[model samples]
Target: MSHAIGAPLIWWVSDYTLANESALIVGDDFGSIAKVKLESETGLKDIEIIQQNNQQLSVRLPATISYHSHALRLYQPDLKTFERVWLNAPKIDWLQGDMGVKTSTGQGWLQLSGKNVDTLNLQDAFLINKTGKSYSLSLKESDPWHAVFNLPKQIPVGSYQLKFGQKVTQPTIPPLEVFIVNQPTDFQQRVLNIKDFHQSEDSIDHTIAFKTALADLATHGGGTLYLPAGHYRLSNSLFIPKNTQILGDGNLATHLIWSKIDKQESIALINLEDNTRLQGFSMYHDDAAFGINSPSDRVINNVHIEDIVIRMSAYRGHPTSEMLTKIYDQILKRFSNKLDTIRLQANNITLKNNDIYGTGRSFAFIDSHGINIQNNKFYNGRRGWYSFSGCSEIIFRNNTITGADLMASGGGINTLGNKVSSRNLYFANNTLGMFNGWDREAFTSDGGGASYFGHVQSHKENQLLLATNLRSKGLRLTPYEGAVLFVVDGKGVGQYAKVISMSENLVHLDRKLDVALDNSSKIIICPLQENYIIVNNTISDAAIGIQLYGTGLNHVVYGNTSIRTGGINLLGLWYGGYQSAWYTLVAHNALYGSANTRKFNPTRTDLHTSNITVEARPRSTDELNLVYGIVIRNNQLYQNNGVSIIGSQNARKNMDAIFVDPLDN
Candidate 1:
């Protein structure tokens, strides 16, 4: 069969011979084995090709190999034509887990055991559902004889085939069954009706009865507290305890209206503790109060807030032109002290399927981790989301954000503050629309601080002599080792080298410099962080589509469509005395810049006035900044005001930025 360019042709294993530690392979017409690769469940390793022919190849398998499923991939010298053949498939053993019940946040594990199971390449393994949807499985734990696979969350509850290479294992004997329940199992029973208490909508002091019911549930083991369909007035905050579930009839049916007139102090209407679930209710606020707060004390963790609607306005009556004007002037103005709709400080929190409207800030995460905010909607807010301090492993996906006002510094999403660094933060498959805010940029991350730099006094034999003043600029010997250093300005511009070692005033690199360096040359170093993916998103009608400032590593932004907006903007700043935002891939995006004069006004005219801007310059005049390993390719930019690729003054001096088919207008 003829294959497309760069496509690997499938070659099935016709015969296999394993004896006396020697291996023989027979497959369809591979021409010759220019190179051979052995893939096991644990890892992939190159095998020396001892013999080769048009239809047969032979090599010595690893001594550790035994009755386990393995794969042999053959490649020609051109490295384009290849074939993957599974070996020792029939002798492998698969261990299936028992039928299990998993919550939406739960995980499933399946095991496989065989001889030399530790040698398997688990990264290449996957689970295929009956509908042909495949989910990649990771190696949860492994020993020499056995390996466990953690099922991905994207896999739904169904029968699936455990596949590694060409070997597929069907469900065995009892048939593995998995069911994913949306709500907690304890919430299914033991409901406390709020009406049973003496809480009424007419009462101005409704906190007394509501607190009584909450304390009553705390006295016993916590369960679901059911709020019936009614307009419930709250004068003060509601504190939720651990293991408690607060469920209402529906978002529109059950209303929790905040009538508190005190604007001096801020408070959360519902302060959640660990393992708490709040859902199916509409929260209305008048004064500066947060709708929900998940604080980061050790007592609070694993919180789930979903199926709720939060509105910043208190007037439940129909809106009139005068009322909206009063709201815009009195409530949402610059002087208004409105708090965020949700302030998340806890870990392992999921906010899903929620609606937030007309708030100062929709969501904020401070020093949190493992946060998944998905399938939500935000409208008429000041800011869509914010992450302060350090956060990791956070995801914002499938959310629709629109109609944000510029009263406060309005934008779609942002991360900032002192010592703020975010790793593994992904924004995927989201739709952002028509953001009219003071800060017109849709997305931004500002790692605020001075950039780190060291002067290269001289270069000799893969070593660059650093100036003595490097230590004064926060350059430490230990951390400088193994970090990537870029030569900014001078003859060595656009050249980078990895630090192999660092001495008192000299830095050794992995390779010798092709050009000599003078005292005027500057070097910038950035650390390594891993795994950030932004894909399949649509953004429109904003000043800037996406912006990353001084904080990113191993990040990918691909397969997105931006309409009538400024293209992606990247600014590498110095944050906490370090250079961040390196190793980024921006590709396969369709960006359409706005031609409208009012919408496409330049925010920073000092920089290049272009649709797509990448800047890596000094924070002030004295400091130095750098962005490394940025690849921008395969992108379509239409009506971009005749400028698609524009770098600031010193930004293009450090790295060779790649722009393929950058502009169409």
Candidate 2:
């Protein structure tokens, strides 16, 4: 031994692939140990040591190896070379697409993939960005575990990060950026005519000739800027980059206006990005603004708002006047007290046939992903609110919400997932309250109607083991894999699965669990919400007409129809997590009630007393809050208070929790 002065501390190694061809190593002192070598990149070679002592060694593997990890050394007994170490080391994971990559023809290669990406090292790969600026990367194809490279035709939009040599990776979820674009060989030069950059109905201002026709159509790379039958005006706010569009001519002949509501300027008088498009405009705006916003943090993918018409031209008065309720109480006292006449955070969005009228609050798709509000109308608003947070594939169809709130807080839709947890929703055929004359009544004080709220992350199921895989977000999430593994409340509540792969706190699932989850179950894995399909919607004077708070699993609520609302509300509450609701169905539907009915006939006043509720409110006592396997059948209640299921174990803990008799008889 050399009495420890320099090298001799390996501290663990192992990973000689080709099915573990032996490597071991370990660490500490180690006195007598001759020769070893390895080095890689086609240099040093001598291998076989096979065994040793004073700590550990093993070795023997060189059958053929050039890169993907090497460096070892060792030698002692007087041949110099003290220790070294290094093995395997190189792991990228995912990056897909390359070799002349065609992000719809902008081109920019990438590939990468995982495990020893052919040992990386194209001068230590690069990419960096967010100000530090790097670039490098070229290697076009190397594969004992993938690698394609190239990226850097122009690279300049935003966010980057990759590095590889000194390692610097973590930070995913729609960021990347990297650009290339060059198209435009005259397809009418991709149409840009804003009257060839001037002269719209000449109210002048035209914001510098519409930002110089959107920078001359972004240097001939993006398209369509049209805007024919105009009235224009705009004092600011425009942006609209990426594959741009912005057409107009019908939304009552294209009238913009927007003078920046007295420069309160909270942004978005347009904004958008990523394959953007804002059709047939008519944006009017007089106070609480927004009109068309997107990119509240990134993930701005394919957006398209068709036939738009966002109103609010400073209280035209009389929609049940009081000077339009003091202009909706001074537009809810501004300074950002929430206002969204379309404020989506894009991800394949498509809001169609829009109308979004008066006062304020109309749409607000936050943390979005695949949303499609179709045939919209949203009338005389103060709260015809259609807010959805942390969204996921949704389709609020045939929309028509008339009046949601003239005063007191109430909207017409909600989807609480705020940070993440909202799944495939398809609220169908929507119609909601007080038609045309618009006076106020689509009510919804969060979960009293049209509420969806979900996202629960284990409130029990004490380490469940229904045949393996149930690890949890102790890592807070990074390996969502496929996400979705419900079992909302009590022993396997309604059972659900699908996640087939995840680590950093395990999750496995693709199958298993027909019913077997202990500690009074209650779970939720991804950004929650499961297959939802509130069908045939038509609610009337709402105060409750469709709520599935804490949703999960197959939700159906079929053929809906409530008239004097307070009808379909299956709430398995949640305050600090433990949210519940599973396998719901609520059938037939025709419930018409609204005379103050009381939980199910406290001697009704006529109808509408919580028409069809399934409340399972548990906050503590070891949490569970269940609503398992719900079914509420055939419905037709007129004077209300029919299918109630509050709390459970066969209802009525002083009236309400389990009645379960939906007329199969």
Candidate 3:
């Protein structure tokens, strides 16, 4: 039993809802955990417990074990967050015994047992954990279902595997993420001020001083170029250096106005190459603006971009020949490799808590290896975020953009490339304007949302002052649930949550995946991009949930449910080419149950679609209905409208193949 009172109490069995209320009551046993075994789909999802109350003690069943469609051989204290794994041998376990073992991977085996060695075959399965470690049922005398696992100190970030056999595969870019550090072998913090450098009265030779500052930043001996609360006009460009910080006085009054004449990102652009940062400054450009723009391979990696605002060039239409030539000569010709916004050929870019606006024919673009654009706002812009050729891995969490319909442009977050396992992108807790887009948009089953992983809230964790003022105190927004059954870590350590908790949580990889269901990381797509698995995620304000472009084979859309204009619109799988979309199982979950929200259909205002999306603004609870799995079951549908098991030609070819039992209620 659970109690919903002053504190919180959790129970193995409880009820959950989709309202703005607490799903499960967290009683005084706040830290207590418990384990519950469910046989059917609906039973598995009967309750909506946010966290575990009592420790779950899972004792292995006596000996003989039966094979299942998808077994919880390895516990990943996360939501449907399993490391993609292909079994090399038939799984082995016990029905009811002390324990039976199955060699799941090279280093690990599914340890199943109870009181005896070989006897009573168990009926159900259970998994639990903390961080780095996972194992078979917890059979300790005192506790049964839940047992917290210990994790490493500085646990390695990024995705790894829990092999079920003897293969060591990898993702799109196991490309080493090398953090370019400062010179002298160690990181030394240097600080500069507006008084340290300035524009000459004539503004000519003053440009020389600007070059000196730029050269210093380009070199090593990392330092900060601090600007007090005043406007420093630059006749030429202000350059960026490696292992350095260009800081501001932390006042809204602080301003750095770039020479609009340098619109081509010449004097206005900030170049980076390993270990670079830009903090606390309002960059006002006359023509166009740039925060950090480096050449190919040259990047500002392993750094932070906090409390900054960028204003782009606002030329009405075209520029004068002189201005264009000057722009080309001063900017383009110099660094044509640089894109419209910034270019980090091969680096890790984290753009957090910043304000960016680009009107006219300008947009913010990225050409990096791993890019994280989070907790930011965009006013009136032609484009917001884009993932061009070189970009393979990306994460966008808690960001908001206003006028996406100002100009005829591309997507808000465009992640497209022909490369395999290309972009391991992530989108959580982000909000987007529904009826907004520069181009004529199309409506689909989902809201405009197609972001990789869905979540709630459109905000980011910022510096101290911002944190104090920005985040709401006692409000816990809707987030990913379910699948935390595989507890990787406990309260702290390297505890990763379920990756597939969100109805939109999906993982697709060429290699076998063995991850915790409750995870907060990116997914692979092809060797260029592939590992994207979605589980119990929610998406009410989206147009389309999951859209597959190329061949989707052996892909399982397990336990993912969403809502938008229609329902889920499956693409590409129909026609050939990438029709390799096989073994995809979209099972036990909820879909658009909001018949009323359908009212937005005829009155739907925003409809522009993009690559991937999620709800940014903080919401009451996980919105939408109670549908699950990519394979919609006939019996499940019957629960709502009692329909018979039937499939169309295309549905039989795609959905039916993945569906194991459509008739079973």
Candidate 4:
């Protein structure tokens, strides 16, 4: 039988049998004529077939085409033999020169040339072999229809019949046969000593081999490309492919070192693009960008760059404000406007137990989402880890950071580069201990002033999930320290913060000379117009608790107990162009320290703010400036320090900002 591709499935043969002098056939009758035949003299005569879909037909006939007309073959699956079932059984447009002539067992011919695979309803297919072996049929490889990741260790080798989907619209595909070759043992397959085989090993040569190996596999039929346990010196970039696994001997003895000592930007070592994995072996690349920069598309899944030590090549940079500014801009633009990058898709991206240090910029970064840098260490470098690429609910948790000191250069865990909003980021149980650099304390510094004033730039986007990770005692800030949760420059002017939920995390900043200069962090920048919420937490051993100065508004600071025995300084409240802060409220608190603790003597504490909530007993210094929308209302007040609120020299006046207490309380 012959059929055209893309034809619809309309009918099927139900039953056929011969009783003495008559023949019977039954099935659905679409519109096409049915045929029934009896084996007596000439050829098939009258055939009875169910042409219409969803309808049945029964017929009685005789021996020849003269007596009957057409014939429907009695088809059934031979339990012990492998068979292919055609989807949308093709039409016998015109049968010529009898091809299927052995007419005994009723082995009828089924055409397969052309048929609309869609209407055939062919899905959920399976394959069976002559020896009773079977394999399931699946759709194209994709994130939705992922490949069978788990391969059976053993299977018999031979031919198999691929069954169409196990549904009404199922069609059998040309059965594909696969041979499972016995892979050699790890020891047997190991690449002998790499050094011994070295012939001036270069990066480009290795890269060429990788590209060639991948091309050969695809062209000559795909197979596992292996790199047995042994060190291979590489000096160039390596390109990988989808639907392919670049396997290496899963041994520490297996290593790949970058021999190319010079390149402005050497590509990543192992590129496990679109949901791939690279387990085993140790890769060492210092001063490079990313060990792996996960794929962009969500469909491109599972990019894991694990069990590797990525060392930033120790190089010298100008380490000036201008240089830092340039690098910061680069990072920000890279991680903007991305969606929920599932941890599974961009997750388990462990920078764990590996060493990433001394690079021109950052160690490792997840510019998109889902990254964990735990149990990792950093040495004499800029930042251990950094990212602004929409990390909406991810962070650096439980990682030991040693050389946290800023090299008169940068800080640790900097995310001040992001301008667009990144939601729900978590930073739990991380330690930023004793270090030797420029900025010691671990915090984020906003990328300040790229174009116009700080008030118009994009705001920082991070919904931080801060957890307790002692950053005290061992942590030291030389050039300038003190205060943990801080930002030096306010780049994202209008960028509002989610919140910094705090509990048990010790933060200490050394008060270097001119504490005010290093005190830059105390002020949280509301660049254009961003708000911050600080709650029940211990903010101590620092110049101040929190500071704000910019065009941002409606920032509420409360529940924070400031133990600043060494005086508490504040920027009262200022309203600049189009960036006037409305409803700025501060209430409920305990400010108990020495007279000196009150930095601004005769300060202005009496305050007012509009439509906002402020409750709790209070204490502390400073007076207040009459600023509208400044509402100060609520409970207990203790021994005060500093001005109740100060209206210092050259201070401007504000409108109807009132202060009131809930008399009921």
lDDT of 3 at 653: 24
Question: How many backbone clashes can be found in candidate 1?
Answer: 7
What lDDT score goes with residue 223 in model 2?
84
Local distance difference test, each candidate: 0.59, 0.58, 0.35, 0.33
Candidate 3 lDDT, tens digit per residue, 76-101? 34333222211111221111110111
How much is the lDDT of residue 128 in candidate 1? 63
Candidate 1 per-residue C-alpha lDDT over 251-328 given as tens digits, one digit per residue, 9 for 90 to 100:
989998877734333367888877789999998876556778866454256778888998884344687988866755
Candidate 4, which segments miss by more than 4 Å at Cα? 1-209, 214-227, 243-252, 261-267, 270-272, 285-301, 315-353, 364-367, 380-385, 404-418, 449-665
Ranking according to TM-score, highest score first: 1, 3, 4, 2
lDDT of prediction 1:
0.59
Q: Model 4, range 1-665, lDDT digits (tens) per residue?
A: 44222211222221112221221111122123333332334643443432222122233344323321122332222222211212123221111000111100111111111112233223444446586766543333211101111122233444344344433322333443333322211222222222333345444245456566666544643344666777666666564554344556653666767655333343355555443445456666543344444443552433444454444442335568876666545533442311111112353244455554434334434334444445655443443333333232233445544443244122322223433223222333444333323332232323221111111111113322112122342322221111112222222111122222222231222221111222112122222222222223333332233333222233344444544322212232322211223334444444544222222335756321111221111112211222223333332333444234433344232222233324201
Clashing residue pairs found in predicted model 1: 40-120, 40-121, 41-120, 41-121, 42-119, 42-120, 42-121
By lDDT: ranked, best first = 1, 2, 3, 4
Steric overlap count per candidate: 7, 7, 164, 105
Report the lDDT of model 3 for residue 271. 64
TM-score to native of every candidate shown: 0.62, 0.32, 0.48, 0.37
Once superposed on the true structure, which residue ranges of model 1 sit more than 4 Å away at CA?
A: 1-185, 188-190, 199-205, 261-266, 296-299, 314-338, 380-389, 406-415, 455-530, 573-580, 593-610, 619-625, 640-644, 647-652, 657-665
- For model 3 the TM-score comes to 0.48
For each candidate, C-alpha RMSD in Å?
A: 13.1, 21.4, 19.5, 28.9
lDDT at position 630, candidate 4? 38
